[model samples]
Target: MKRVLNVPGIAYGGDYNPEQWPEEVWAEDMRLMREAGVTMVSVGIFSWALLEPAEGEYDFSRMDRILALLQENGIAADLATPTAAPPAWFFRAHPEALPVDRDGRRLSYGSRQTFCPSSPAYRRAALRITRALADRYADHPAVAMWHVHNEYGCHNAECYCDTSAAAFRVWLRNRYEDLAALNHAWGTTFWSQWYYDWDEILPPRATGAVPNPTHQLDWRRFCSDELLSLCTAERDVLREAAPSIPATTNFMVMQNFDALDYWRWAPELDVVSNDHYLMSTDPESEIDIALSGDLMRSLAGGPWLLMEHSTGAVNWQPVNRAKRPGELRRNALAHVARGADGIAYFQWRAAKAGAEQWHSAMLPHTGTDSQIWQDVVRLGADLQALSEVRGSTGTAEVAIVWDWNARWALELPSQPNGELRFQDLVRDWYEPLWRAGIAVDFVRPDADLSSYRLVLAPNLYLVDDTGAANLTAFARRGGTLAVGFHSGAVDENCHVRLGGYPGAFREALGVRSDELFPLLPEETVGLTGEVAPDATGTLWSERVRTEGAQVVASYTDGPLTGRPAVTRHTFGEGTTWYLATRPDPATLGSLLDRIRSEAGVAPVRTTPDGIEAVLRRGPDADYLFLIDHTGRGAEVSVSAAATELLTGKPAEDGSVTVPAGGVAVVREPRE
Candidate 1:
């Protein structure tokens, strides 16, 4: 059975700020919210000025009225602490609160998240504000949950302020226990960079022709940990005041803010909430959105909140373009299909003045007469009609391993292959599976792979002992594995594991890649072998050898021409596929098909080009979300007929034509 939140249907509404507008507009706001079926509204965010007018003095008169207005309207509140954007007075009084950039420049109030996360002044103020908010709203019926500090982090690395430098020294002491251990971990012996005292240590250099990438990476990791502690401080205060209400920090998807390792903080979060914004020029833009949804669902271990996403054009990106008709609903349905408990935009109403003035909102300056308003109302009513699919969770027999620490380490390694990126490899494999209508699990390396029929480890360059053990166990237990180029070469410390590439799993994979051949962007190598399957392109080629495995594909190269480019080995009852070269998308698709047949994995539905579909079944019902990702319409064919849950119409012939940006959620009588 799929897990559900307090509500049985999709939770609607968004970030509302009555503080941003006049009280005369409150009535219209309520009417429009009701029209959109907004049951919840997050409030008190970015209201530090209203909450705290002075150091010791506090004011909640405005907040009290806002809460009363919302409660009277039967709207729940996702209350924020107003600690995210502290007032200028606080920063002026305590200069330590200001953040210093990597370039050693102290930042002023140009944006939110400019406060030093490790600053004592900031922590003290954040605790006070959070405690006050929780205490005041503890018994309020409209209070839904506590939203701690908006977005939590803004990629602030390279803080050399005295406050941060002092904290960094303490952080290093705790991590390495001693100067000697720190030197060894940092490999300081290589550049004669040994540190005699803790004070000699410095934050990673900001700019130079040859910067220490490894130190910069470690510093980034340390900064992330420090910010997490800041969140923990506020969380503890809230927990003390109100034990029942859930607490969460909003995460920006794919942002370089150090907390990419949510597994470390998932325990603290009641529900993982993330802000999703898809920026792509591809017609299949919804795939990027869908991928973000899957990533969020995996992070929370269950259903997560669609905390913040743009309904259309975002003012922040280089290009801000409004979404076409039906695109908003299509994006919303993607989140719902991936097990999101609630869906909300960044703002209910557009800001007239601020950094996000031009960002897309439900209500623009012109008010409810706008097209966006109508779209919101239509989508809201449509969502209400399809409430039965509330708890449907994505089911998949294929799993992909994602490791943030490993990703960070690999990018920061002081070695060859500086261009190696984790997201590139993961996306290369994921898109092919997605196109094939194959649902995949974004799981941890330590996750139990027994349930999955097939597993993919693309650019899994760094694997600890436990991860290696888990992969080996899965292979021995009759699970098919697909690993790509530059995998299993190094451990977490960026050191080669000694025996050979892939260490313990060499026998299981039945292949050993001794050398890595870097290719130029325009370089071409035609792959010709049994497994090529017509895949061709210059997407980073490599040469490999097979011991016990059979050569499936070979690269036509200089000296290594006709060398194994792809190999397959039968291990236990299953098999392992290794790709030495980065195959083109077509070849990867063919490889995916082959693996699906070998593992007996099945797809839910298939379309010509534009349409994407997935079936999620709960204990008593099955829900299908179909999306059209192409510019032109595409026809979808399904096995079972269903009732159009969005429209309550009977679906016939197991087929439906979807126009671009069109979406359908159907519920059928389960067999």
Candidate 2:
């Protein structure tokens, strides 16, 4: 059964902390919440210091008052375990629980998430607090869901302390079962680092030279597993206390943050939730949000929650620029368009003092008359208007392969080009699809591909044998496969495939490479012939030869001039494309636009630039969500007459005009 948010329709609210303000202000907050139509708020996420000041010591006074206030105001509480930030007194007792950095420096407790994941003391304290909260709030009327230990690995993902080293060895023993197997997997023979005993193994600590790639990879895998183990441990306690409540921990699934493999973490979650904040510097931030929303939706395989996003500028960035007039609505609706059933922000009220004081909230420092507050109220009403969109989900004909392991390996030391980014490679392809107004979903390389007609794999640097086979079979069964450069070069063990450059996909793509010729900084390669007339590439180029495949394009002027830059091969009734370099966005979009056509994947609805169209189908109707990122309005045509949900107007003529920088959701009833 699909685990859904307990909110009746669209969950509209953010993180609420009454403890930050005086108790007298709680009534006003409740009034404001009702005015904003806020239905749910994550409570007590970082209240460990207030809830349990000392070890095993409990004080539910503050938490009880908050829940009672929520119940009185008709607001649902997304109750949190508050294990993300352990109290200072508890930390003082277990000083070793603090994380040790790679350089063997013991970090002091100042920021949140100071506890090490592998520390026995930290785990015990975290679970005890979780159990206490669960036992106290098991049948609380205001409690709607269980949020287990905030973002699992935001501050401390990998630790190299003595405790972590011991835990890593245990993890390795369980994984390999024997040192001989571990030796083969880690390629210990190269560095004369073979270990006969498990004690000799360490957690890939600060090494003089480039650490063993496989060893580093395994350590990363273990770090993700260790954090997940704690999450499930706390979640299990919650279940034992309150089995009726669904539990989830928010995931940092955005780009620039890649510590934990969310693909593995998603299945363990009762419901997938993600915290996405836009970087002010990113010019294409809107598209990035769409990418993240699709990923969250894909992780849940249906509806998801936008657990955290700012109402405006975030303080963490170097220069925090406030959102343009209509961006807040566009941002929230973009997630809804991508299949998020709930929309929430990081904070409900602005903080008077904190590291994130400048981070904008629903109620900003400017108060009720401010633009941010007005936007919040309007958005609440907007979400309420689109309540019919709940229970509907979007299905994409196109999927982009998202592999955390591949991303981890690509960023490891000693790759072809130090400048190339795995995240950029993904955006390079997805940008074109997004620009073309096509809907997309993210899929793990090994997951089901039958639902998608086109699969875009952008630089899968590390893929296992099973995943490689899965992608190959997906293409063989008539799915159009577009593979990016530097993909399929290494196995899961981080061992290079000896025969060719693109190891696992050489035959599937019908292309082979002798060597990779990385372009220097500011270098550009021109692509001519059949790919695109103006197609140019940057950062990477390769010597590629084709077998049983047509040369779609060739490098017109580069180190590999006149060689195949792009190839198209027909495999088992499907077509496969191989791109040897990072094509400029326009050229990439044009090429993918062609591929999207070859796969017979049509857009849900075509719109102008910066305006996206997506469709979600419910039991009774199909909802068409057209989100406008541009400040200008545009008219879009639909296939059938429908009623626009937000405006409460009928688009009886099979066409609707989206408001400038706003969304227009039209629902067409199922006949």
Candidate 3:
């Protein structure tokens, strides 16, 4: 696969808005960029007003100077199309371009991503600006890649305006081909809501009760497609005007922004880039970051780009806490360890004015005298030293299935339980493996499972016949399969599969659920056999019966005491495990340990708590990244004799020490 950027080492630097600063500050900014070892920067983002002050009139003078200065400093440019936030004049000329919320309130145009995606006026303006930028910078020596737009559908994912309604009608007609088919698919006969004409249907607005499940689901899909259409429309412009430059749009996959289906969008873009922000409320933010990186890399099918991260606290979170002394470096290296070819932050300098003034940046308001600036310089040097680590891919023996459709289905109103969340189940399963030094890949349900020894799907609430068949085939081919609660209960249309629960994989799993016994938030159940003695289950439970499976663990005390809480069955050459409830960490770890042993899967290396060991393999060399996420030092067992790329010293005695909040990149020769 072609790499995103043609840089020799890991590309560094971030979004640079030189237009926000004074003219003299531009030269100093370049000097500081060079001093900090910045090699690339994303310019022209959120500069639509400056780029085009009026319709049919354009001004590239400021951007021209910025590009020239960056080239003079030997820095490559990731040029943006500057259409994310249209100027106030464009909206004034076309008031219908603004998006409307589900409550029928028209959103104002003071912020970014305020235009409706389905508006033809918006599309025309976006394409015009894209063509102008591509024509102006396509031949520039500083241009390396084209940033299509900044974070598509970030704020304005779904627009319930008239334009969107009309486009949605077209989308529905294209999908169903006829009104009768649409009625059957949507199950519109319920509640006497049958549609007689295509125009009678509308985007699911706020109703007294839950809207039709299929209607809401289809609307979500349609909104995502609309935004994707906007992206592809501009991408075609760049592809024609600048055939050589690759194009990409930043994805916000960190917080479950499932408006756009990334799996569908991944194939259309030249490279996959993601924007992630830390959840200060969650203590385990590092794990979330790793999860995002792995998911993005999987979407790209190789190394991806960290398009936007933060230098410190952000402006949007409820409580934006600044990073500790070494937290910033640790976070950046974490992404690099997990198949990131490039790392960039949101902004280069702290904004003097604007909505993000409080947001941290590489060059903070304190100038170069602060610890953040010093750390930024040090990180740049570190990235330069470890440039050879670029293009290496992380290896994993286990794959966890994460589906956006399933997540959306699970979050729909009127489910079995109100407290059940898709992310909670995923973290419950992923945390144990992550802490045990076992590498994992976040995969889609239909992704190739032949190379993996084990596959775990948590809360796979929505499954199609193809996905179910794929899982069955994986198990039959000797791959261990583990599935969690509420899986295989429904099809793609949110309609329950007939006959029994876990409908499609019932035979393969050798089990069936007769009833779902959801627990209250404070409820808990005890597990007795073949698990941790003190193990307890919470959040969910199910009354399960075995057809041919053997009971691995049973509930000791609860509503369904003495019932099977976990079961295993041998199918052909492989085994299938079912977890009927959310097990505590110790219990989950014990179960995973058994699965790992059964599949002969081993960790790359062993480390103490707060330290992570990840291996990235290339054609000629294997890179081992040891990161200490704690304030205290930790030790790791290095099985192979390898040279530490950062220190140029050989790791002897099969052991290495990683300082508090430090990283060690070791390269071992591969046969």
Which regions of candidate 2 deviate over 4 angstroms?
Answer: 1-3
Evaluate all candidate structures by whole-model CA lDDT and list the values in order.
Answer: 0.76, 0.89, 0.88
lDDT of 3 by residue, 360-460 (tens): 99999999999999999999998998888887887988999988888888889999898878888898888888888888888888889988999999789
Any idea how many clashes model 2 has? 0
| Model 1 accuracy (lDDT, Cα) | 0.76
RMSD of each: 2.5, 1.2, 1.3
- lDDT digits (tens) for residues 74-176 of candidate 1: 8888888887788888988987678887677778975676788778888888888888888888888888788888776654534667777778889888887
Tell me which residue pairs clash in candidate 3.
Answer: none
lDDT of 3 at 580: 90
Please provide TM-scores, in order, for all candidate models, with all chains considered together: 0.94, 0.98, 0.98
lDDT of 2: 0.89
Lowest summed lDDT window (length 10), candidate 1: 1-10
User: Candidate 3 versus the native: TM-score?
Assistant: 0.98
Residue range 106-222, candidate 2, lDDT tens digits: 998978999889999988888889888888899999999998989889999888899999999999989999999999998999979999889888887787899999999999999
What are the clashing pairs of model 2? none
Badly placed stretches (over 4 Å) of model 1 are 1-8, 155-158, 207-214, 255-259, 280-283, 413-415, 502-505, 531-534, 537-539, 631-641, 652-661
